[model samples]
Target: MSRHQRLLALLVPAILLWPPLREAAEASMFRHMLVVFPALLAAGWFVAGALNARAQAAFARWNGMGLPGLLYVTVVLTIWMIPNALDLATVNWDVDVAKTASLFSAGMVLALSLRQASPVLQTFFVGNWVTMTIFVGVLFQALPTRLCNAYLVGDQVRTGIGMIVLAAAVGSVWAYGIWRRWRASAVVDDGTGVQSS
Candidate 1:
């Protein structure tokens, strides 16, 4: 396999395992959503890719919009995540951390979707996705029964589920980036080969 494929293989398992581990500390409902969300997002992307050439073209255009688009997404996500972080202080520490991470991940998706679509934005999305994955893994490792105990205060399940959704969002972006890179490389190879011949 190529380096990119290898990287993708590593990333896929990490993203897939994140929510179930984290959800162990929360409710079953949350766990369900975590699994469902990524599946749904993947399905959506597949449908769009198959049915809407315009959307694919739009993503390409957005990706090429350069610095202005990146700046816009960064600023917007930062502004959105700040209040969510502040809200964290009012909740239980663990709950707050999970929620805050979800908020950040969601903000990234929204920001990137609104801006010019690009593979780079996909990279940012994947970074946030990996972060949530790590957070879930850590929570499970640190507090396994915490998820099972219904008596625990705060919205652990909801937050966990949100992270899963966020991961799916990130996965969609990552897939887009991979597709874009492959297309670009193919074009370059074709042009160079034609010129040399």
Candidate 2:
């Protein structure tokens, strides 16, 4: 099977199973809302990657590795969004909305990163990083009030840890962009090589 097909095969079950699993939790409604954005974002990223892959394939660039990397990243994000089987409350409308927004924002950043031909991708990546930093920083700062009620009812550690991991992922991506730019600039491309402008 093609890598894209294999990825979809793995991802389909996870996406299908998430809703029911989240619904089984005590906070079913809240958890469901929280997942809605991530699920949509995953779907959008997958579709875009597939379309881009097909385009590249038709143009004889099927061996290109970019789309697969994007797909893998989307898969990782999907797994991250999956609530732990032991998670207690499934429903917190406020926190759900905030989490969903954050997921969407992250997905936008991923999409921007996948635009290999666009120099604008760099701008989008940096811009989205700043936006994500502000958004998550605010969420972390307001966690006390926003999550206070849920915290009283469920595992605060799980929520806190998840946020921390997400922050790390965002930071890692930002660092990667910077590193990639530095590497691109440092390379002295001979006439036979195509250097990024």
Candidate 3:
């Protein structure tokens, strides 16, 4: 895509961090947990994609080195997924800054790692991640009381529903990607180097 297109795409997510959207995000756990987090992540991912090839090369190098980097991303992801963490980000300025940084960083790492990892590994990561999302969703739904000081029970319920829906959607996409990859690989297995539609 062109530079302008890239800029626009990047801005689309960054816009979420601005006044109106930012206010909306901070208003409840559902928006914070799902909308704002995703928007920031998309901003990072899009920015990474728009950058010169150097960033890609760097992510590729990091991925090539193996588990340490992936482990780091995993930890960052897990930390931010916590309700307490979300509450902190909502109410504490310091924590909010950290949240933005960590979320974006995690997004960059995740996007790069996924790009470099083998399909099996990618599938494994997605499977595990989605499973966690589902678990968390169920937990959120089951919680008898509000888990975060900033959000109400209703917000938590909505967040839980969003999580479950997101998991299902991502799972479907991952399955489709796997099927496509498998079909492509199978076509190349015959050694003729031909691609099958």
Candidate 4:
């Protein structure tokens, strides 16, 4: 990363963790999940770039094929997606800290694992995550009452819509990349009589 990029990465988690900003993010379920959680994860990803070679090697050794890291991320995401988990995090300082820490770790692990993971593994994990997101979004919208005690019915509905849109966008991009790669591979170089990856 460039110097400026590294500085910005360092600032992100710090700014997000600041008392006022943290409170603002947590005050609404929409911001809490969609904004704060993602921000923390992103912050972790950025921070991972700064890790020393030894640390990276260790992580790679422990997270063979990225499966373990991906699984950890999935588990953390699943937990925080629960309505009870959200409510507890909002009301309890302990849960809130756990939420922040785990999400951040998940981001770092995701960055490292994704680099090591094969295309098939990446697709499996990402596809499952996207599908789960859509399912949760639909549940949020279809429920008559608010799922999270910390958020209102309207907020829940809005968040649901946002989640669905986000999932669709991610899925679309992933699919497009896959399609482009496949299309490229299908082309044969006449001179070499070989396929391009």
lDDT (C-alpha, whole model) for all candidates: 0.45, 0.46, 0.76, 0.87
lDDT, candidate 2, 68-135, per-residue tens: 43444444454333444122223543443344444544453355346553445444544454455445
lDDT of model 1, residue 90:
30
Candidates sorted on TM-score, descending: 4, 3, 2, 1
Q: What stretches of model 3 exceed 4 Å from their correct place?
A: 8-21, 65-69, 187-197
lDDT tens digits, residue span 35-74, model 4: 9888989988988887878999988999999999999999
**Models sorted by lDDT, best on top:** 4, 3, 2, 1
Q: Which residue pairs in model 1 clash with each other?
A: 25-147, 26-147, 62-116, 62-117, 63-117, 63-118
Measured by lDDT, the strongest candidate is 4
Of 1 and 2, the candidate ranking higher by lDDT: 2
lDDT of 1 by residue, 1-197 (tens): 34344234333323433655434532443443344334333333233324245764665566564344444434434442232442332334564344434433333334435345455654664565457564663454355354434323234445554665565666777677688878877876786566321
Give the per-residue Cα lDDT of candidate 1 at 157: 42
Clashing pairs in 3: none
**How far does residue 34 in candidate 1 sit from its true spot (Å)?**
4.1
Q: On a 0 to 1 TM-score scale, where does candidate 3 land against the true structure?
A: 0.84
**Stretch of 10 with least lDDT, candidate 1:** 40-49
Can you write out model 3's per-residue Cα lDDT over 1-197, one digit (the tens) per residue? 66566556556445655667767768988778787777777766666667678867866775783355456666776787788888787777778777777777666667667767777777777788789898999888898998888889988888999999998999999999889978778877777766555
| Winning candidate number (TM-score) | 4
At residue 134, give the lDDT of candidate 2. Answer: 45
